[model samples]
Target: MERKRDYMTVQELTENEKYKFWYFKIKECKESGLSVKDFCDKNNIKPSTYYNYQQKIRNILC
Candidate 1:
């Protein structure tokens, strides 16, 4: 039997989808009233990785 998957792999996502996913994550972090370190820790994200995505999103927007 084939195993079921619950998450999409990065390789399976389009560029737009990847951007939107990270974009919403960054926005959610900002609106959560928590520090970057706290948010990342709570969400199981690496703070550096989150900052990188935030930078990428800002570059895209600006």
Candidate 2:
């Protein structure tokens, strides 16, 4: 029998972790005075993905 490797798959992140990750990125962008595009580019994240996360945070707060 072969053992399965779940570690190779994508791991689910907790809500707190998600919040902290996005919050840090958002804060970094603000402090760096970089446009969203530049920040996402420098960070190797897609702008659309970053925007979606940003919108989700705003929606939850409202």
Candidate 3:
């Protein structure tokens, strides 16, 4: 039997990784035109967590 991939959780992100996480996410969204659910499915992230990140990025930009 094959095991599912062990995905990283949002809480495990180091302070420095925040920039990288957001950058890649925005790039993927902008370039691929993927919805949050689609992007999360492709990247193995949870929707709620992705929402939190989106808010964070919005805060940073504003």
Among all candidates shown, the one with the greatest lDDT: 1
TM-score of 3: 0.62
- After the best TM-score superposition of candidate 3, give how far the Cα of residue 23 lies from its true spot, in angstroms: 2.9
In candidate 2, what are the lDDT values of residues 1-62, reduced to their tens digit? 99976554333446757877897787788899889999999999999999888887778778
Best by TM-score: 1
Write the residue-wise lDDT of candidate 1 on 1-62 in tens digits: 98989976777677778889999999999899999999999999999999898999999999
**Pairs clashing in candidate 3?**
none
RMSD of model 2 against the true structure: 7.7
Candidate 1: Cα lDDT at 57 = 94
Per-prediction tally of clashes: 0, 0, 0
Cα-based lDDT for every prediction: 0.92, 0.82, 0.77
Candidate 1: how large is its RMSD? 9.0
- Judged by whole-model lDDT over C-alpha atoms, candidate 2 comes out at 0.82
Which ranges of candidate 2 are over 4 A from the true structure?
1-13
C-alpha displacement of 57 in model 2, angstroms?
Answer: 0.9
The digit string of per-residue lDDT tens for model 3 on 1-62 reads 97775965666557549767776787677688888789889989898987887787877778
For model 3, the stretches where C-alpha displacement exceeds 4 angstroms are: 1-13
